[model samples]
Target: MRNGLSVDVEDWFQVGAFERTIDRADWPALESRVEANCDAVLQIFADAGVTGTFFTLGWVAERFPALIKRIVAAGHELASHGYDHKRVFTLTAEEFAADLEKSRAILEDLGGVPVRGYRAPSFSIDARTPWAHPILAEQGYAYSSSVAPVVHDHYGWPQSPRTAWRPLSDSDLVEWPVATAHVAGRTLAAGGGGFMRLLPYRFTRWAIARMNEEGHPAILYFHPWEIDPGQPRVADAPLKSKIRHYSGLAAMAGKLKKLLDEFDWTRADALVPAQQERARPWRAAA
Candidate 1:
């Protein structure tokens, strides 16, 4: 799509799926791994001259301050991906607020940029937790990319707006849910996450193109772990988790290069104002 791309900057071992087997405390060496992986991502973006948002976990920013600074220096948007990988839906409103505030502070302090956007851990802000939106606004976030309008093993808001739309929670806060494609009666893969790794490259490109054709911006997201297949295995996870995270790791970089070549993408913040105005009926014809 001509819209934009947003990357979640965190390593694979940091994900919640590995929590049961490997607690965050157990993974000390993951720090160096994340730093190396993030640099690889920076090289990719640099080669393409692409400026995209990097929603970083507070933990990542805290340890890798130089990386966060490099992202801002490269003219990319810096948004929070929560303090840890804790799901917003699982936290009480106050707890969730704390996580968001902490993450915002950490990112801003490190990047010297105002962190106004958030993407929930695991894309967990679904219908059951509609309250999360209003809470996000109340906590001073300007936009959220936490919901995906597709069903998955962890999180999906099937009925949420597929395109960018202002939330009733507060006029300033917008909802830019993950892009989705219709297959039969179901919402199929649109952009990033496991779908980016699992689906064929052509399918992902087609889904994004369809969104642009419909006059919407596709928000593509990916994790650092998706590109690192050599990462230590989390054998404790159910068979499905293993397949989801590791299935196509080797091909991710090539697929991403093709994506950069095919789509006209940029950071979400750079496109936010126009996207917000475009959502207005009065501007639709313009």
Candidate 2:
């Protein structure tokens, strides 16, 4: 099976961990490393002969139109990651809609592709934000990989489906929730991001292999910053946040290279065509 591999394209300072410590207004003043980081990731993908989806922040696209073009030129899919990286549940429907529209338009214009995919900042779509699904469908998004089904302090919809499924019974908008595996009677996050960075490479490999063995394609995601260990640290962040954001950074690039070598990967868009033929309305399992 061809599983999905994605990069959440955002700068180090723009991550949720530093949101409280860093003000948006100060963003322009900070040294921007997104371009360099993105270039590195692109090269890694190029070397591996793989194409993955890039969920880019509109703020980054606006400043680095060339980078967005580079991504498109490399044959990777470009998707939206919201305008300013705000959590979905924190935004009212109106706010979320506007943010989505702005980001989509900007990305489409820059990447020269129909921006059909969205992965909310920090995987923020959950039980409290059911409205987000219909809104995405209404706005022309083909799918979203926004729900991380494991329980976490910042985000996760534990009751949500752990596989790819439509969130609404009547909509074509598919929800490709992040990959997880049942181990020792608990659902552990086996996908990418912090888990991929912090956990031993063997464990993550096992998780993805387990899902693939069951005939389900896993959706793994990571940020460009995750591979850039020398990124500037946010000193004011809480210790837990700091650890979550920075743990195992130095080894992430090597581990990612191993992951790419191990898995058969493709963009999230590639999964939709087959899924659409058999798509069903989502209902919480009783």
Top lDDT model: 2
**Lowest-lDDT window of 10 residues in candidate 1?**
277-286
Quote the RMSD, in angstroms, for model 1: 3.9
lDDT of 2 at 147: 88
lDDT by residue for model 2 (1-286), tens: 8989999999999998888889999999998999999999999999999999999999999999999999999999999999999999999999999999999999999888899999999999987886899999999889999988888888888877777788876678898877898987778888988999999999999989999898788888999999888888888888988999999989999999999999999998999877666656666554
Listing every candidate in turn, what is its Cα RMSD in Å to the true structure after a full C-alpha superposition?
3.9, 1.4
- Lowest lDDT 10-mer window, candidate 2? 277-286
Model 1 per-residue lDDT tens digits across residues 143-196:
888877777777776766677777652366777877788878888857777787
Backbone clash pairs for candidate 1 read none
**TM-score for each model:** 0.93, 0.97
